[model samples]
Target chain A: MALDDPRATPPPDDPAAREADAARLIGDERLPCGRLVSHAWEQARAAGDQPDPHMDGCAFCRQAVEGLTALDSTTRTLWAERPSARTVADRVMRAVRAEVRLGRMLPLDDPTRELRIAETAAAKVLRRAADRVPGVRAASCRLTPAEGSTRVTIAMTLAVTLDRPLPGRAAEVRRAVAHAAEQELGLAVSTIDLRIASVLEPLKPTASDEPTLRDGSGR
Target chain B: MTAVRTASVERTAARAALAVPGVSELQPSLRQSLAEAATRVRRTLGSAAPSPETGIHAERAPRTGAWHVEVRCVLDEDRRALDTARDVRESVGSAVDAYATRHGIPGPVTVVVTVTRTTGHRPSHHPGTTAP
Candidate 1:
């Protein structure tokens, strides 16, 4: 066996550099997506194989595997709970509609007739527009309609894979949402209240339908 | 100015929105359903429950007397949802306008359409009939 070389340079420790390396690795198909990595973890665990070198050395893959393992453990603990009746999309839409219904309407200044835009509808427009941004999901929205203007309050959830600057992302989300609402609905948004509810880590592998080793081992 | 009842406006708008082809159904959001379910459970346990709203939401504009209509409907998967949404918008808008004109209401009505879901029970590219 060859002796381990002490002069070899280790992998980069900076978060950006590591992410750049990960992107390159993904492009090269050496380090696959997090879902594949999680699946590989499961397979390796079941096969009693050694941990792959990429995961052992790469921070990105290691975090993903850990997150998956933690999620699996958490899911197992809640296995007996009743499943949700509605899909996530349905739940989001419902919350938005209910919130809208409760909002006070703002008046319009049309010369032909008395006009108004419901605060709820304006909120929905903003939420949908904000959700279109990458890495951002609008969890909730509140619109306070004023004289010829509206103030938007948005509670957004974020999905982040690597260490990206969150302030920049938040600004981008705000601008995009504001622009979309103004252009699409023709409403003036005076203020935007953004609340970052939670940050979602990278996507993990879905639980496989295949029987686990635990189930088949005894049989 | 003729007195405009919100109920009448909602009814007219809902009728117009439903008239659009490929509209599957007006659906409440899942969150609302759960809240209703929880309220039902609470009522069974001796608590008050609030009624849930359906898909269409209509109200007067803020600061102005103009009416605003909001609708959320599911569409058939075969048809283009965007085009169907546009059709629904125009239909709702015209229906509101007609109601205002007939009733002699002084305020204008604006309709907002939101296509909430699409049913994929049947594929668009089947061999038999072309999707309308």
Candidate 2:
């Protein structure tokens, strides 16, 4: 600005005055290029679609104008559409939900190798394995890394039908779980400890019933 | 230059991992993505979710020249997660190794695969068949 301009700052000889002007400048809107967007906006408004030489010469000023133009377009758009608050909330919530994740991880084969899986995710798979046994419904399945090794110990609570002996059912579940761990997931099963939580009325005559399972017909 | 190579390798790794069976989807490392979002001055201006180039991080050790890669993914619930992740690790490793070999970047590429979550679908397991 020219020294005479009323909007110009007082001489820099007075540090306090310069600091105050600097503070005011910061409160104003600026483009990514560090130029005041409002000045370029005013020039654009005055030119009435004609490109001005000052803004054309300045990269920062041109950037400011483009940003202001986007803002103006957005303003007109928002005003014209007046979208519902629900729409805005849905959009925001979708983004928030997308980012809401990450949990305890379990190592795959070798801890040194860095292959891992989400702890809960792995647990769910293991639990489902136990649940696959006829008349066995696994309620709780927990996995913890055995100290100093990549192998994991599984502790599960099962509810099985009274038709079969508890030991027999438990053995079946252990086999199923162990097979799943080693074959399907490539997880090392250290030990599968089971707690018979509750006995339930046997599930209605599925072909792979307890008798079939007991006969070793169930795979 | 390091960033460019890392990005290139990460992209290749992501593509390879996605193609592997049982890899339902890929996700950014929560910590890395959070740090990026936090450091930026504008939060609302961020990209939407499930965007490409977020999940895989590949970096070359300055001294050893060994490239360390981390992959985060969501596995298909019906498929085995461990085997899937192992496959992912191998797939990513092989793809990255090829990229390194082509670029003539030094050092072996080692990949660590992480399962972030699994897809919700769990098909009913057949009674006579061993559960997957």
Candidate 3:
């Protein structure tokens, strides 16, 4: 009888029967026993025969493979817990290839690199100082490199208080910033533009507005 | 009569100036400092009292035929310090002009702006640390 025919004798104590039973219990859509084994074996052999272009181009895949090779003996024991080696390798390879392509397009060696870095640093310093000043609601500051020097500008909103004059207060803030920039950063700031964007009313009650409580208990 | 009224007006103008932006720490101590400076100047003059014709010494008068204004302020780093100073000058000058027109004063007003300090945030690389 032909091997494909049912009339052919099944292998003694057939492992295929157990595999079929397991597949059935798992509700697999594949056909039973011998055919399933043959199909799977053919696919594995076919995959092994094909060329993988990703193998050469992907750094992540290379790294993963290197990692797996380093854990060669341990990987065998962990094989079931881990995903299939081929699948893991393929995923890593695809990601690394994409990263490499993007990285190449955006080269990090521009001529304005130092200027941009300095401006960024100056902006950070201004932002911090603004946050510390009381009655300052919000602030934004920037430093840009011009032809020979730098220009710094600050915009801020203040909390309204009846106690002091607005113009004088704004002047004080401007002076403080100039001193800080010169002393701290050593930047030659040509201009410092301060704008009083808005003023908010103070929340606390003034001494004159507080009501006296009876029985020496100020309520 | 004009001298007494001008003195009162000058005091009012000084108080109004306290409302301007950049006047952070307005304490009695600062007011005392100004007062002490004025007193020292007066003491140095000694016996040279104001002549009857001038009414008040021209040097000590707050008004130069109109309103006289003085401002002390602090500014942020982001602000153009010189520009702000110029703006203050213009604003005060205009305000004085308007005051002169309404009050029928003939002299020009002078606004002196002294920038005491500068303050503001700077950009930084790290979130927590201040920029160097």
Per-prediction interface RMSD in Å:
15.0, 6.1, 28.5
B24-54: candidate 3 lDDT, tens digit per residue? 3212223333333334333333534422211
**Which of candidates 2 and 3 is the stronger one according to DockQ?**
2
Q: What fraction of the native interface does candidate 2 get right in terms of contacts?
A: 0.40
Tens-place lDDT digits, model 1, residues A1-219: 121221121244755334323223333223444446534443334333444665456665566545445434333333323224554345555667665564654432223212334555555556665555545557677666554333434444434223356676677667766665555444455677677765544333584422222223311
Regions of model 3 farther than 4 Å from truth: A1-116, A150-163, A203-219, B1-132
State how far residue B40 of model 2 sits from its true place (Å).
11
In the range B1-93, model 1's lDDT, one tens digit per residue, is 222366577677777877899777776544546565544433443446443235666777656768777776766745545456667777888
DockQ of each: 0.02, 0.30, 0.01
TM-score, candidate 1, is: 0.33
Candidate 2, A103: how far from true, in Å? 5.0
What C-alpha root-mean-square deviation, in Å, does candidate 3 show against the real structure?
A: 32.7
Pitting candidate 1 against candidate 3, the one with the higher lDDT is 1
What does candidate 3's lDDT look like per residue over A7-38, in tens digits?
12223256543333222223323333223432
Give the whole-model CA lDDT for all candidates, comma-separated.
Answer: 0.53, 0.68, 0.41
lDDT of 2 by residue, A1-219 (tens): 111222333454665444433323334677665556656655655564565787667777765555545544433344344445665555555545555533356677765747887767777777888877877777787888866778888889877678767777777788888877775566887888999876766545564444223334342
